[model samples]
Target chain A: MCRTGPSPDPPEGGETTSTDAAFTALLEDSADELYESAPCGYLSTLMDGTIAKINTTLLTWLGRSREEVVGRMRFTDLLTVGGKIYHDTHFAPLLSMQGSVSGIALDIKKAEGGRLPVLLSSVTKNDSTGRPQLIRTTVFDASDRRAYERELLRERQVAEAARTQAEEDRERLQEALAVLQQSLLPAALPPVPGMEAASHYHTASPDRLGGDFYDLFPLDGKRWAFFLGDVCGKGPQAAAVTSLTRYTLRAAALHDPDPVAALTTLNTVLHERYAAGDPRYCTAIFGVLEQAGDTVKVELASGGHPPALVMRQDGSAEYLPTPGGLLVGILPSAPFTATTTELAAGDTLLLYTDGLTEARIGEERELFGDVALRDFAADLTHTAPHEVIEAMTGLLNSFGDGLDDDTALLALGVPTDRPDTGSDSPT
Target chain B: MDIVSRNNVTVTGPQDAPVLLLAHGFGCDQNMWRLVAPALAENYRVIQFDYVGSGRSDLSAWDATRYATLDGYAQDVVEICEALDLREVSFVGHSVSSMVGVLAAAATPDRITSLIMIGPSPCYVDSPGYRGGFSAEDIDELLESLDSNYLGWSATMAPVIMGNPDRPELGEELTNSFCATDPAIARVFARATFLSDSRDDLKTVNVPTLVLECSQDVIAPREVGAYVHDVIPGSRLVTLDATGHCPQLSAPEATLAALTEFIGNQS
Candidate 1:
């Protein structure tokens, strides 16, 4: 340290220089000890954003020389375009208003033109008269913070993309499952000349591909055959059984149109294929559609499936007379029973998968059972094919997401004598 | 009455490849550019639209008489530009749409920025001097095949469509996409599309041009693209390293890089 007066003895320590050694040591140590090893970057800025003073810590962090930043650049010049906007809009305003702001975060654009994120707290210094002197600030390196935020954003984007892809995959699977379930049944119901028929396969789960199927196909000269069945179990194994049942039933019907004989043949075939310990079986009702002028005959046979519901034109409803039949394919050649009923004009025959009657609605977990379905059928007997479908579909929809299986439906009815015969089916 | 739809136009980008108006080819709507549009969006205000009788555009606006000639499609391009208040447009055209762009560019030379054609051809017939690859007899056979076979699924084009799709069943979606077309009208459109000669008007395209040629394309030959390139003055030809009739489908990244560099350089 140099002073205007003559050199003095070093603070009475014998081996001396003529100065205050303590003050000299403090001045010398300030540059290397405090500036280089300071907690953060230190700088002084002019009121108009020019840089006046900077420390070695900041200089080293920015990879620049002392001459390059101080006097040559302003604090705003050190900011990137975005950083500058933040400085002008928020930092400068808040600092000017308060006369001092601290712990603020900003990026000091490096001399290399790349971004250098920093936490910069600043204060306006005062002169003796309390007039504003210069702006003083300390900058903490925020590279890790910026990188972390960028990674967080990238991760969020990837998660969002993955979520979208999963949703698409799930939707595609549902559509595929729907189409597979549909293919197990007929493409569309065969039009009968003298009767109305409606069928619904209530699904318990959308995710699980169920093993229930229904179809109304034209049989020979004046007959149409329809059937509804529930294959045992769930998932892919059940799907396979459903596929086998569909093809075998069609083949059996072609061999012999008699309902009992068709059921017997299917029983024997299933028994032969899956009589092992890991055996499988299903319940079914097959019927031959017969036209008798204004009346139709449904000679149906049962193999442990639910009985057909007969809703008369007179608004009367009853279960068809089907009794004493075992489940097909469970036993080796199980016996099936046949029953016949006459369906007069405006009469409807309801056929459905077991999911409709087996659904659990109340707190007791009691089955929905046959009575509710019968009542539902009684109300919808006079409605057209579409109305019947809509009513039944509404009932199933009321079940909500509770119905977890796949569903298939087919509806047919003899048209009423109106000028417009082409009334499209109901929603 | 010519029955065609006139909706589904979207404008997005830098507001700056100037305005590049794009028209899709036959049998598809504007959704064909889903993969490549985002890249072009960075530099150019690219416009994409659906032509009636295809895609999700309104079919009710189709008028048979007005749409009978190529001039009607040209008028639609001009009308859309005027409606959106677009000027100095860079028009991009695909197969059937290339000729439509040519006709539109000719009508309003001042409004066009450039013409960028992807998979363009003048005619489908085998002339005395020129070979468009398909003969008149071949095109007829193709049309007949379309009547019988196009109704079912085409595996390549299936996923590209976001709307009704034809699968192995050939029922509902088939009726919507292929069966919706009147066989007679489609046949007429096909004939008009394949038989037209637009080489005479190529020289008259005075705007700055860019021809994006897809390599190994069966529909639009490289030679044909070169022939068109020679006719248009001061036009830059960029041959993309890709195969198939659709570059936006087969190679999106390469197409994006090229368009970005070219548009940036030009700007």
Candidate 2:
């Protein structure tokens, strides 16, 4: 019984071995058949580059009888000119050192003078002594792949050009907004003697800036002319009319001393340029200052412009009113009005565009309208022009992503603290 | 110019006697002239050696770049004549090598008495209205076929080129001749041999020229050979009844008769 157990196990193992032998024989037969009929070419060469053997697939590709190429032709002879260079520079050296190389592209010269692109992979075969003797190479046709790659590159270039054009458009929009902002304000505010005056203008977005501007140049010593306004429409047409109005104001100022005459000249130019058809126009404020002593004389005009805010040294502020003024360019000889005020020490004035007052406050669609700005200005009555600008900048920042349109703010101030106690101190 | 290259060569021809130098084409080497050599040896000292990369010559010394042009082969012909100090030499080159003889003769008009051009062509391309027998494209196809079937067909076609080998394995050995030199070197020769257009040199040959046009030649047909004679200066066109390219093998008796008569007339 002891011997029977071991003997029975041997026969069982022997039966499994026979089954394995049959399975292996089937695999060998299939492999031989596959090699003879494979769709792609197969070849092997000596390390010295002589073609040692080849298959029917390659023979058919060459369109030659079997007796021709093998043993007589070297592998390099079959290459086209460009293919040969790639082979020498990249393929040959790589194959030699690595003893194998793969997916190498080549063009084999056909019997008819045309060339067929192909991908080749080769491995070095070694004898029992571990010395490489032959290279067995497999070739796959690659004509379709090359065509596809060329198409992809052409499409990519077209897409890159489109992206560049879109970027150029964005830059142009920002520049237009900047020019529109400049047209709303005077190029200069008439300078006041014995009074230190300064103002700041800040942009919200370069792509679409808030239209704001400020300037201080001499109308006369101790006297100045200044105004600020905002247009209703956006983009290039609005910018053209705004440019016309700003230059017209300067020209009319040189023609007459009256601020009202300057405002009328700007309105007439805007109407002629824009009011004919598809007219665009804006709201504006104009003012003239004349100083004799501690008190300075002032005249103001508004043409559908937001109210100008004034802050005094006594911690109180109010909006100077000149209502019922129409849009400056919509009608021929568009209606414009003026206002006057006396200047005091430690006084501040602010001008702004509707882009800021009309800004959305929250998801509720609530607007930070003119009243809210008036309240904000009142809070800054005791502050200087720079302090008011900084505070306004912080308020805009707190609005986060909600400021959808352009905003322009201009602020001007007269110093409360006297460094010299000069002519403005009743001396 | 026909190129002549040699480190050392043996030239055995008479000092003052009219020299007739013979060469073979394709499969066979210079030794193919052994049958007619003894006849010429009776009067003129004959010179013969293997081609640079063929037969018994040094294969290692072959410069692929130089020997790649038929000029190198033609140069050897010119040098052999000069080396032997032969004046008024008659160079009889067969098959592709005949063009080499024409070029060599054209280079040194004084040394070559005449060129016996067997088969020559200005170009292998077929003209719009004329057939040069094979179009240039056809020749290219033949070259590609040669590349693909170089091993098997060269062996199979050897006896046809060399006629009868003393041993059966001789055909096999000649088929493997492509491997005798580096396969790359053989490639250069194959291109230089078949692609040559030597018709331009024919008219420049100042010597009295004779082109032997072989009838029924598959390699160099009779009509094409006549075209060669037409281009050459004062050349006599003779068409012999022969079957193949190597008339020396296919019609040696007829070939011998022709050579002797042509040379004897001058003598």
Candidate 3:
């Protein structure tokens, strides 16, 4: 019986004979025969890498006889030049110190011209005295593995290149958007004769182009025209509307220096250009400043825009309201409200878009509102146009993430004392 | 930067003896000298360090722009000498590091006294009237080899290469982490080692130098070794009875004998 002295015997006699025959076949395979014909190549080398003995499987892969490889060639001679260098630099040093190395990939030069990729493992065999005498190595054919690894490396390189390209493209687009956004606004405010003028613009995000724009340019030798406004939305579409509005107002003011006529011209152009299914609109304050004796006379027209604030030299602040102004570009004939004021010495007039008053503040998400802005301006000690604009800029920055929209600001004032030169000079 | 920790410097042997600075080549770290370091340490103070981006050195200290050229490696050597306040030291450099030792010696003339170059080839690519034993295509093949090896380095191999202290069984099975460099860092080092041309700097060597060449090295052949010896005036060239490029590992006894003889003669 195959069980050899078992208490219980099998019920099937046919199965026992088959099992016994299989065991007999397995036991017939000798260790020496298995070593020579193993699937992997095996070899034994001296401490200095001299090939002392090698199996027939390794010899067959090398395509050389045992006489040529054993004792005639060192282990390095079997490797490709590149693999040899890698062995000397990386593999040899590790094996010597660690006493064993596993899964090191290298290329072996075949007898005929091609190369065989292999994964090699070697272990040092020590004598009874613990002195290293021989090295036992096993080599596995890794042609398929190496080919797969090469494919992976190539894919990795391509992915890295694509990522770098995408990053560069994103940076270039941002730069181009920034340049286009700057073109919609004035480079600088022209110097107003016998007055001081200052302006600031803040964008909510760098990626999306801001729709807020402002400019102050001389209409003639005596009077200066200025406008500050915000379009309905952000990005390229709103920027286009802002550009059309800015040029229309500038051209219309040259034709007629009256504030009402300049804004009316902008209204007509915007209503006609964006008159299709998707309508575009903006809120704007167009004004004119002229030297009237010692004070500057300011006349302004608003198209559903926020009322301008006047910070007086006597520590008083109030909004010069023009009520019932219709939103521009809603109809062919939109009614705009008109107002007039005089800026005395040390008095400043500030115009801003709704972004400042509509900004969210605190945990309650409460709006900053027009009343808070008036109080903030009244608390300021300096009434100069540049000082007012600077304080307003600081207030806007303090809002931080609370300010989620584009804001534009413009300030015009009369100086306390006249300068020696009557020529136009920027503040 | 704490230069000791940054470069993974390890000092052994007598504190009062003359210092021997051992520098490893590309594709390896300070562990390359493990076999030969003990023999040299018997009389000299042995100093071994891994280059930044090579071994257990502080990888955060590695800057691509700084280490892009051989001069950056030389700066590491100079800073190590300055940090230890060492003088009259013997520099033993293997492979690409041999050129680095030349640069470090020139930068600080009084600090490094002698240079021992083992299997050094200044230029790996062959040009007009020069034999560096490798063609440009062969170097590209070497780079491809590195890339292939890196693919196998990620999952199952990383822990084995970098010792696994968590499993004591695997820990004992762990080999030296000489080649356990970050793949990106290894790519840069491979490019620097193979694509560089350092032939002109050999003439600037003023220290007593020893050019040790293996009798049969696939990387640095006899012609390249002879070229290095001929360029440097008053340099000694000894052909060791070795097989591979790393004589220190393949023939440690012969490597030690040549090094000790050279160092003893300097004294």
Residue-level lDDT tens digits of model 2 in B41-143 = 6777565655666543555467877787888887776777666566787887766777787778877677877767665555545677544555555555444
- DockQ scores for all predicted structures: 0.02, 0.01, 0.50
Runs of candidate 1 exceeding 4 Å displacement = A1-37, A44-49, A74-137, A143-165, A399-427, B1-267
lDDT by residue for model 3 (A219-297), tens: 8888899988889988889989988988898999999988888888888988999898579998889999888898889
Better by TM-score, candidate 2 or 1: 1
Error of 2 at B84 (Å): 73
Show how many residue pairs clash in every candidate, following the order shown.
Answer: 20, 22, 0
Q: Would you estimate the TM-scores of all the predictions? A: 0.51, 0.50, 0.85
Tens-place lDDT per residue, model 3, B1-267, is 899978889999999999999999998888789888988888999999989887657777889888888888999999999999989999999999999999999999999999999999999888899878778777766766676665234446554444344664753433545677777777788778888888888999988999999998878999999999999999999999887778888788999999999999999
Clashing pairs in 3: none
lDDT of 1 at A197: 59
Q: Which residue ranges in model 3 land beyond 4 Å of their true spot?
A: A1-14, A187-200, A220-223, A290-296, A344-348, A383-401, A410-427, B1-21, B35-48, B57-68, B75-89, B107-113, B151-177, B251-257, B260-267
lDDT of 2 at A427: 10
What shift in Å separates residue B8 of candidate 3 from its native position after superposition? Answer: 4.7
- Worst ten-residue run, lDDT, model 2 chain A? A1-10
lDDT of 1 by residue, B1-267 (tens): 322224556778876547778787654446557778877777678888766544444455656765666666677787777777788777777776778888888887777667777777876566888877667665664454333323323434443332323453432324224222433344555666667778887778777667777776656779888877888888778888764466765466777676666555655
Interface RMSD of 1: 28.3
Error of 2 at B209 (Å): 61
Task: Give the DockQ ranking, best first.
Answer: 3, 1, 2
